[model samples]
Target: KADAKARSSIMLKAEAVSRYPSPAAPLAYGTAGFRARAELLEGVFYRMGMLAALRSRALGGLAVGLMVTASHNPERDNGVKLIDTDGGMLAVSWEKHASELANAPVEQLNQVIASIVVAEKCDAASVGTVLLGRDTRPHSEKLSAIALEGVGALGAAGRDLGLLSTPQLHHLVRMTNGEKGAGPYVGDTAAWNSEQGYYTMLADAFSALLSSGGDRASCSPLWADAAHGVGAPKLEALLSKTPQLQVAVANTVGTGPLNDGCGAEHVQKARLPPRGYEAPLAGRDRAASLDGDADRIVYHYWTKDGSWRLLDGDKICALFVGFIAEQLDALALEPPISLAAVQTAYANGASGRFVKSLGVPVAMAKTGVKYLHHVALENELSVYFEANGHGTVLFSDRATSALLAAKAEAEGASDEARALAAGRLLLVRQLVNQAIGDALSDLLLVEAILALRGWGAAEWDGLYEDLPSRQSKLPVKDRTAITTTPTEERLTSPLALQSALDSLMAECPHGRCFVRPSGTEDVVRVYAEAATQADADALALRTAQATWELAGGVGEKPTGAAA
Candidate 1:
């Protein structure tokens, strides 16, 4: 009976499948997430349902929740994500499972079913529950229907949380855990983040702050570029949830959601020429844009000359850390929180050192937020950063209490640990002053410090004092230039890359240089950071030129003067 329903659902969705047919799987998992050709709706749906089922079982039979739509991926591309039982991201280890299921034969798939049944210790007659949510893509509607076939086939009750952000789906899973008569079951929520739930947290934090003092009139209106993905509706939901904040959204309808016009990936201010203003690749002040799913953010602030200063991942991390620190000081806290921040390799070293000088502990990880997030989990970190503007702060109540107690018991004068402990008393006070990683969380730290101590972004900028730098990417005609294999291979001759890096580091405004083959495309990513902008540019260009030569690809030289 269930199989019949499943077949009916797929058959009903046949027209959509035919229309989409799944784009040539032109995407691979990038640093932040996976992206694929939008036409491949069937493959995407297959992966989605399998992940949903796997996540469900991982959390003790809790309904697995899925958000179906690629956030910020290119228009020709789409994606699927799994929210875990605790409303956190699914373990990266599970990506392999998704791949396995995606490629399994019908017979092999049935074997997987038998294995899961035995593993879950369930009888053939038992059923589970799974919830699915999707965004506005035309293919998404079809993918959802086909995915539903798989969900129903699994004997899992299916519920719909339509047009939700990744964060909202996460929240739904969390809320369901506490709902009345929701379950006699394991009671765990979904197993991943929701695009909508993040906005909810932001809204919650903002509402809490506003309610603490100001009335409606004193509040400022906020605007966003919806990127024609799921960001608009989710942002709307967030504002609706927090009535105190006046929110106006734009560029939502028919926007491409990638590094297209009017998104964090492109478009700065209304002033920077309507088009061809691509240098900074994001807008200036008063507006912002989110990718398809809204997990990451980029700033749109302007220079004094009315030129745009698109705040990249490094700037955002610096802004948040500085802002949170000031908030801690205002409450007369003596660094009680013992702040520890983690950033990825791609992040600017200036921010890392700046954070450390403030007596906060900092760790450097590889180039992914997942690594940063893991460090936070391992250290119970108060904050973490990625050069790409992906970040979050630790907010566990249990962790806060421990820090407070540590600070409270420190003697008037004691060892470093004791002093560190005493310093921690301010963490709770700071957290209360500023909600944990609130999306409404602005770059207030610089202004706050200026107002309080006569300091500025330049002052923070002095910590590691970035050397002049330049960076560019060159594409290769063949995948052979980089490795096409799933396994890691040398993107270019290591010795050649090292020689270029050594040359750059030996020069004034000394810095490092490296070459990376893009995980999602056949391009070589050349990065260099130095004290003098000229040195940075030269180093980046040289390394990139070397990479291009190695790959047998022609390339253009770096452009524009160092700011």
Candidate 2:
């Protein structure tokens, strides 16, 4: 009877799927997932639901996660990213299957599902379970229903988490899967799987880190921009729990369109605070911005003289590297764990140099969190962040075990060493959101670190100077013509494009340039940096022109300085 019901469910669901069909041009799951205009994504979401169910079956019924958000994209745009049972991005092999299933025609959808079952050895009778969540987009509720319908078609259990930040959903997926003897879950698995659990965990960690240090009063309040998305309410809730850490949130919920001239993307692109955000008087008045989905953040502050300075992902990684290194030294563990920083080619040249100067090795990954996460996992402790403020610190099981043992041993050590060891180790583990790059968690980390170091945003920004940089997107008729190295540091396709860029870079001091196809959009991205802003802007435009001329660019050449 159960088997028959499952088959019936699939048949009925397949019939409902006819309402949404693949576009004439297939949608490719990019660095994140299927992101485009919301109107074109109903079919994709339905198909994603089906794929999520199959994936759950493939993983022996472990809970999979589906997040409906576009991160920093505009309001009209939406996307779906599948999370594996372990809470990471979907596996590369499965990513291909998802693309295939998403683009499958309406009539062939059932056949495609069958092929996936065979390919993945998914048990049709197994109960598929999926955790679904969405952001604040207007169309999210409707799209989510389509997704649930897809899950129902496969006789899969679906848990609608209502609205949640992207990282919140990722954390819930990890916690749910961790309940299955996956080596002692982080915090309380039950509590950590709920919205309140997430807020409480972060608040508790922040409180602990604050109280561990001498005076909590010394900690400064922050000005935060939530991109008018979900982070505003979430941040408010978190602050309510940890009253010791104060934040005056701007662009709060319902106040503005999502990511409309505010957020990490705005800060990174414009090198200024979001619109309508007023920086508090200079010293110690730090500010941060969370993107639409609250998975990425960029921090900034005004100097005593009122000049604004920004600290992006590269600087974040550098500061964390220094702080972690100091803790490791103070703890004086018997066998030191290896530490490395992971970055993409887009990382500023000065930031990379600063990390190397600290004697920490650096590894380059492709331009995405999953790629960086993979590289970070290779070391005992790895710190990674993209230039656009998407990243988190990763501690391996070995490192976690080592820290725990060290903390245990410190119980008998000198009082000062013991206090330092206990506070730093526990806070390090608690402060970072290991499931993904969480803006709220990262903000707490920055606050904790700033307090510990007795420094303000100005002091942190002083760690390294960012070389002036510019990024441009050129519309290319065929972005496929552009191929890049594994790290995306060098372009290998279109023959002499690299050579042309090399000549252009040579014209400016400390100049660098690279071009690659945008994963989420239809255009190609060009990045350039130099000793000065003027040189960087000029190099970027020239490099973009070269890319357009060589790589089937369709529109008029990009003009003016980089925005």
Candidate 3:
């Protein structure tokens, strides 16, 4: 009876919304989910809701999450990424199903859903739930409504978390699913499921970390660029609770164009502070930029010589690895805890060598957060980051248990050893977001580390110098022809392409080059690094031209920077 009712409701809702014309171009579920012009995402959003309902039903009603965001993209663009019960990206296997459902013609929509139902063996009678959240994008509200309508049609329950960061939504999904059937604290589950809980948890953790460390007053105030996105107000709320650290926020106007010449992407690409980001911060004061969705962060600061220095993902990983390794060494447990940092080919060679110099192992994974996250899981303590600033720290169960045990044992030790062990362990678990890369969480972690080490951005930047590098995108008739090795450090297709690149690289000091298809865009990304900026740029252009010639490029040969 329940199954029949759900089917009826679903059909009615689908029938009403299904009348909207399908897009001329089929939607492909990319690494970032269905992202495009906001005007074209209504159908995709509706179908994603249905898929989320099915996913919830498949998991026996554990809450799934739907985040409406385009991350670093401009405000005109919008996207949706499904969150699994574990608060991670949707399983790789289901991406195909999502693509099929999203692009299915209206006439065949029901057939597509039926196919998925038969294949996954989802019980229609089972209850389904979806937790929905959106960034501050203008189109988010209408798109969210369309999603909710789809959920209703499926007869699934949903809670609209009015406005939230991507990480906040992930945190809620994990807390909701993890806390199920487990008795809750603070009156009920609602307390933990709200944004209040999210802010409180991070605030409390930050407070604990600050209290456990040396004088916090000596820390310099940070200049933060919120990219005029949702993170600004949320960050303000967060800082209110933990007042030890002061931050001056920029580009926080809600009505402003998101990621418009600002945000992590801008900071990283331009290697400078965002436009309109003057905060009177200079000398020792640090600065950071959060993407439109606040899932990634990149740090920079003005030096005494008046040059802006960037501390990218690679540097962040080094700092984290060094700190964690020091803590573990102090603990000196019987069963050793292995610490490793994960990076992509985009990582600067200097960063890799720096991490190795600290006696920490480094692993290279293909581009994308899911791939990095998976490889990070192999180590007891994994710190993964992309050069573009998307990443997080993961602590295995063994590492968490060992840390707790060490902290307990330290309670009876000398004051110096006890403070080192307990404080470091607690701070590690509290400072890093295990679920995903969170700009706010990472920002706090960076601040805490700077304060503890008594080092300014200059000192940290002095750890290593990034080799001159250039990245260019070449449009090809078929980007799929450009296949790569597992680590994306070498090209496996376009026979002899790697050889040509190697020859060019051999001519330049410290030169390296690689080509891979962009997962999120329709271009072949060519990366080259060398001893000098001019060589790097020239090598990148040559490599891109070679790839274009080999991979069926669409137009005339690319030249100069466009190459």
Candidates, ranked, TM-score: 2, 3, 1
Best by TM-score: 2
Q: Tens digits of per-residue lDDT for model 1 on 1-563?
A: 54444334333322222322233533334343455666655755764575576456445566667767776566666667666555556567666555555544444565554444344343233344577787677777777776776666555666876776565565566545433313222122242124444444444544443333324323334356666667666667656666654556766746443435655444321212212233322322244555556555554534445554445556656655665565455434444445577776566667777777777777766555556666676553357755555566654444455545555655433434544433433322232211112232332222222233333333434335444445456776764445321212123344554555566567745576766666556666666777676667767776666665655555554343211
Q: Give the deviation of candidate 1 from the true structure as CA RMSD.
A: 7.6
Q: Give a tens-digit lDDT track for model 3, residues 1-563.
A: 54455455445544535545456689888678889999998888888888998888777788899999999999999999999887788988889999998888888887777667666666666778999999999899999988887777677898898889999998888778764522221122455566787777777777776666656424678888899998898899888877878888888957479999889998887665786554335432788889999999999877666676788888898888888888878877788888899999999998999999989999999998988998998998899999999998888778776777777777756546755765676666756676789998888888877777778888888888999888888888888888999999998898688888889899989999999999988888989899898988899998988887778877789888546
Give the lDDT of residue 376 in candidate 2: 91
Candidate 1 positional error at 463, Å: 9.6
Instruction: Residues 1-563, candidate 2: write the lDDT tens digits.
Output: 54444445454555536788886678988667888889999999998998899899878899999999988889999999998887778888998888998898898888888677777777666788999999999999899888988887787899999989898998888888884524553557866768888888887887777766777425787888899999988888888887777788889878989999899998898777787655554333788989999999989887778677889999999988998887887877668889899999999999999999988999999999989999998998999999899999888778888887777777656557755764676677767888688898888888888887888888899998899998878888988889999999888897699889889888889999999998877788989999999999999989988887888877677676552
**Candidates' lDDT values, in order?**
0.52, 0.84, 0.82
Task: Report the lDDT of model 2 for residue 546.
Answer: 88
Question: Whose lDDT is greatest here?
Answer: 2
Q: For model 3, where is the 10-residue window of minimal lDDT? A: 180-189
Q: What local lDDT score does residue 109 receive in model 2, on the 0 to 100 scale?
A: 87
Model 1 gets an lDDT of 0.52
lDDT of 3 at 273: 77
Off by over 4 Å in 1: 1-33, 112-126, 178-204, 210-223, 241-247, 255-259, 267-285, 326-336, 403-470, 476-493, 550-563
Model 3 alpha-carbon miss at residue 551, Å: 2.2
Error of 2 at 191 (Å): 3.4
